[model samples]
Target: MPQDDPWDAEASQHVARNPGRPKAGFYGAVPEDDEDGRHPSSDEDEEEEFEEIEVVPVRPKLSVAIGGFAALLAVAVALGAQTTGPDARLSYAIVLFGVQLLGLLAWTMALHPPAAGATAAIVALTALAADYLAVTGEPARFLPLIWVALGGFVAAMIGQFIRAEDRQRARDSWRSTLLIVLGAVAYAILLVLVRQPLGAQTILVCCTGAGLALLVARLTDAVFPKPRIAAQVPRGATGVVLGAMLGTLACAMLGSYLVLPFTPAKGAVLGLVAAVAANLIDLAVNFGEAGRRLAGEAPTFWLARHMQGPLGGLALTAAAAYALTHLYLS
Candidate 1:
């Protein structure tokens, strides 16, 4: 019976002890199992999961706060340092720019709505104040009133965009981008048509139209959407379209600047170029952030879901475009 033992007793014991364990096959060391040998989750899976998480870096919050406070302090110091009364007031403008600029950069990177809106408001107010101071007499004194109204309008529009409670997608983004371009073109055309409408009246009409348009756009989106269109345009395509548009606009502006020296245009081509160039530069930088958003990366935690805020690239682009168009005309 002992002579007839057909199996190795040690091997049989090992097999019994480690059931289903990979074995040193007959050929070499343990033959790798036929299981999918990936590192558990795929890269796409990780990104999708990451996209779900809001990424608000702590450093930005602290840095922005410190910078904002320091800017205020600097403004106070500048005021104290000034010898003349007008200069002291002028220091306020400088302070305002410093604070708002720092805040704007932070809000843009952090993608926060309230913070960004506040920053923009500060900038507009400063500009208005500076304009008022630079002007002469009663009109200048009343200028702040006009600014107050304009500031409110700007604030409201930016707030509406920021607070819009809707999930973002490619088609919606593109549509918004188109509408913005159209709006800017319309405003530029309107300025020409209005000829010499009082500034106050012009501002009022523009604000009213903008408010109505925003309402209609929101309502239309809520009510309509076919299955086919949804399938065709995935979410976030708007960002890409906007990026391309900005880049193209920038290129065109540069081209015009290059050509300006050679030919004399009826209008101030150089001024147009300068205005567009300034706006395009800002847009170019912002589009980089928007590009990440479109790619489904969670770039900011503040306006994590909504990107219609002042700091939002799309909103900024529209603003910049309008400013560029108006720079020479105004």
Candidate 2:
């Protein structure tokens, strides 16, 4: 039988290199990380590997559990709100404060910005002050949370001057501070909401929507975190939109039974605001983490990183709840 193709050329192509002394390193070569012994691949194998590997999204069990926890907090918020008769805001305050501390921890750890300790301290103190103002001040005073946030901003700036040595850190510290401090103080809005005539009911309705939105989004992401918002951020657009719709539906149902100002239509509008705010903020945290990771920063603890997303979302929802309730009721 005749050979299909000649092997001589292929065999010739496999010829060994001529024996020679190895070339010396260039004088212009960079010295940084030289001792690490890893050389840049000309073939770009890592990028190919990244493209080939599938993203492992959040586990269904974990998503369900996290969502369940958010729902549980919703229950707690309702219970605390109802318990707000004489001298009982303390119970709700306790609950809100505990959550604020948790958010503080998660934000501080995930951000790891300069003057982190100072940022945490300022946020904690401001949260305490804001809660006190909300609890003791005249009913429907929206000024307290604002004032506390302003103070936090000032303190955060001072902290930057004192502790931010890196120019990059000086730029980033402000963002970290605002996220942590503002998030902590916004919880006071609920206290203000509780002071209204139908405030507790409002709390119930709003939290139901907000919590359900987060819950649904999480569970949805676990099952179908596809059409992902971004490759690095493992959340799906499907989950976010579906979560918002369902959350609005839940609030509308609650509002139908509750009262006049909180009619189903009104409640649905509020739910839309809260739900969108909640999901977006949660998604924002993931985007931030992705940014840091891609920039070669140290990875945050897995749990803390995940925990911050929900906590930030809920925190922002407080302001949304206050603004919307006041718009409809007042």
Per TM-score, the best of the predicted structures is 2
Deviating ranges (above 4 Å) for candidate 2? 1-56, 164-168
lDDT of 1: 0.35
Model 1: how far is 124 from its true place, Å?
8.9
Candidate 1 residue pairs that clash = 169-236, 170-235, 170-236, 170-237
lDDT of 2 by residue, 65-154 (tens): 777877777678767888887678888888899989988899889978577777788788999999999888876598767878998888
Superposing all C-alpha atoms, what RMSD in Å does each candidate have to the true structure?
Answer: 17.9, 10.6
**Model 1 Cα lDDT, one tens digit per residue, 265-305:** 31223223322332333334345455666688776644322
Report how far residue 134 has shifted in candidate 1, in Å: 6.9
